[model samples]
Target: MFRKLIEDASTWHWWREWMLIFLGCIMMGTAFVFFINPYKFVPGGVYGLGIVLHNIFPSIQVGTFGYMLDVPLMIVALLVFGGQFGARTVAAALFTPGYMNLLTRAVYPNEAAVESLDPALLLNGQLNLSDDLLLTAIMGAVIIGVGQGIVVRQQATTGGTDIVAMLLQKFAGIKFSTGILLADGAVVLAGLLVIGFGLGTGEAGEKGWVLTLYSLITIFTTSRVIAYVLDGASYDKLLFINSDHHDELRRFIIEDLDRSATYIKARGMYTGNEREMIFLVISRKEVRQVQHKIKEIDPRAFLVVTDAYDTFGEGFKPFPSADVMQAE
Candidate 1:
């Protein structure tokens, strides 16, 4: 068993997975160092909590707090999710904080050393772009989303809230995405209370509501980006057809579109006529071709096309196995 484990760990695929995780950690760390942390925006997850805590305790680094939190969470993951998730989650959890600390040091060595929230401006205010909350929100979302998407695609995550979300998914029978939303929602609310209300005293006079709205925007953007990266963009179209020339349309779909179709026998209630209904799913790019073929076959053919958010099968995304762990 030990030898086999060693062999599996030495494989190219294993190294590739670790490398992708490292890259993801770097991107996430960069997002925190340059955008999320400095701008005081909470994008959710454990790091969001870290951000709020860092504000209260200016002496502690956000990444350090993240590291402290991740240790226990990774332990919980080991017990709940087994070894695969445990090992990778450990790597990701460690790497994220280390990279965040390293990047902060490299960019703002003096500020990082001081343990303060005095705005680590790049090049003596030359590159300090933390003023615009909207820009920071969007940029941080995209960067963190892509980083997270990459890690999630590799069947791992940066740990923290991801572990909690996964545990909820396992025990509560909730959707992974919904679990993430719930976990992140709580973190964002906490951030609002801390930053906006100044630790519930409302004495800080901060724009807590506005910050909450920004956090919502960040969550929406990140979710959309993650979906695009994982299941692909909303480029799938589902077609439902009621046509007289079923044979021609079937042939066109099979031969021309290089796609398959399912046919069902149906009856029109008003006309009391038996009909053949066809159902097909194709990429959005193929819409024009399908329309052209349908028009040629029967101009008056009844067709309805709607967006397909996630289509998993032979032509689309394959189902994730147990190895493909989702992150919050």
Candidate 2:
């Protein structure tokens, strides 16, 4: 049974999914070691707060603390987000702790011994101005954001706060983006509290606030960029047409529009009558053309259009293409 399941997963492109997850792990690990951990700059998510906590209380291992934190969130996800989402969260939660543990052991040792590239700035207490807070925060955000984008592209997550967001979205009817805000907001607030207590009222305290603000900015900017880059090229339109003039519509799309169409059997929900459904995936620009063609065939045709954010096949963007020049 286990072997059969493994084979089934393999057939369904499990290796590609795992590769994306591994890429996320590398990005998260690098962000932790290079930016967040070294500079004591926390991000917005659970991992961000973990960095702060790890700095304040060096006795507790970050990996262990992070795993402990994510356990309850995963339970909430299971109860609220259903089996598939919960299962994916579980995979991410498990992988994160192990990955962080390995990173700590491998990378943290080299951190203290390594010399800063901005050694002169460090000697003059100008490291923060030069490349300390802002640089770390931006780099951390970019790395973590790209990692998250890759995971999301594969229809997975890094668990932690993301699980909480999903659960809130499912159970509380909160928007996913808003849920993310609430989850990460709490962590950022915690980081502020930690910094306030640790650095009292002094120049150091003011500097801490600056770091916090910059970190927040970095996280937001990086995540947005990742989402935009991942989504921009993938937005296509899937059009479904059911009409008496199916032949005309199909001909127009194939010949005039230079698009392909697939015919499928569909039933009217109200009438309970069999019908032919014409399905075609086209670029956003081509949607208007498809609409015009449908109208030209039958103005009364039942048409349904859905946004296809990621389509993998022929005649789609991101496929190999030959450059062509238009003569004037």
Candidate 3:
């Protein structure tokens, strides 16, 4: 078993997975070091909690807390969930914090600089958008969203509240999304009390509610961006064509577009007429092409198009992520 594991870990596909993870880790690290940590933005995750902890213990860096949380969490996850998630997850969880720590040290000369929250010291004042915290939150959200999205695509998680989310899904029969929101929501609320209310560092301020609102923006944007990454920019178009030029349109789809369609016998409810409904699924870009062709072939051709959430078999992904996950 050990030999097989070692051999599996050395394959080209394994390395490719690691390469993507490396890229993802770098993106996430960039978000933390340059945008998030400096501003003390708690976007909710292990790192977000780390930010809150760093405020309380100014001597320790946020990334250090990440390591402390991640290592134990990784072990607990492995024991509880088993190894179906693969080792790439462990690598991602470990590497992200190391890279964040490296970048943070490179940016801030010492721990004092981090606690000071001096814009001039953080990122050399280039990204001191604290004055424009909203913009900072949005930018950070986009970056972290893309980063975490990439990590998630590889069938691995960064191992924080995601573990909690998964556990909730398994035992409590809670939806994964709802579990995520619940876990991260609690963390954000903790941030509001600790950082905003100055319970952590004992420096009271009015930014608690304001920061809470901004954190919500970050969380929402990050979730959307991650979803966009996973689902792609646009969904496939499901086309239903009922037209005089059915044969011509079918030829255009099969011959020109190099795609296929199905025919369903149907009757118009109001007209009491029978016709073959041409059904097809095509990429978003091909929608316009198909529309124009229908217009050219038959001016009054009845055409209906709807978003195809997932397209499988022939010129599309063989299976959806949900199916692949179930099979695993």
Note the Cα lDDT for every prediction shown: 0.79, 0.66, 0.78
RMSD of 1: 3.5
- Clashing pairs in model 1, backbone N/Cα/C closer than 3 A: none
Is candidate 2 or 3 superior in TM-score? 3
Tell me how candidate 3 scores on lDDT: 0.78
Q: In model 1, what is the error at residue 284, expressed in angstroms?
A: 1.3
Q: Which candidate leads in TM-score? A: 1
Q: Model 3 segments beyond 4 Å from truth?
A: 1-10, 84-86, 166-179, 320-328
Candidate 2's residue-wise lDDT over 1-328, tens digit each? Answer: 9999989988778777777777886787667655565565666676777766665665555666788787887887677656865676678777876776666555433443222212333323333333556666777788877787676555556777666655565567764445666677777776776764563222244466776787677667655645553454455888888899877886788789887888899898999999889888888888887788778779999889999866767766454222110000
**1 or 2, greater by TM-score:** 1
RMSD of 3: 4.2
User: Candidate 3: lDDT of 203?
Assistant: 83
* Candidate 1 Cα errors over 4 Å, as ranges: 1-10, 109-114, 200-205, 326-328
Worst 10 residues of 2 by lDDT: 319-328
TM-score of each: 0.89, 0.60, 0.84
In order of lDDT, best first, we have 1, 3, 2
- 1-328: candidate 3 lDDT, tens digit per residue: 9998888877967778768877987998888787777667788889899988888887787878988988877887787666856476788888888888778877876778866656678766776777888888898889987877777677677878766766776678775445666788888988898888998578855667788788888887887777677666656999899987777987898899999889999999999999899999998888898888899999898989999866768788766644122111
Clash statistics: count for each candidate? 0, 0, 0
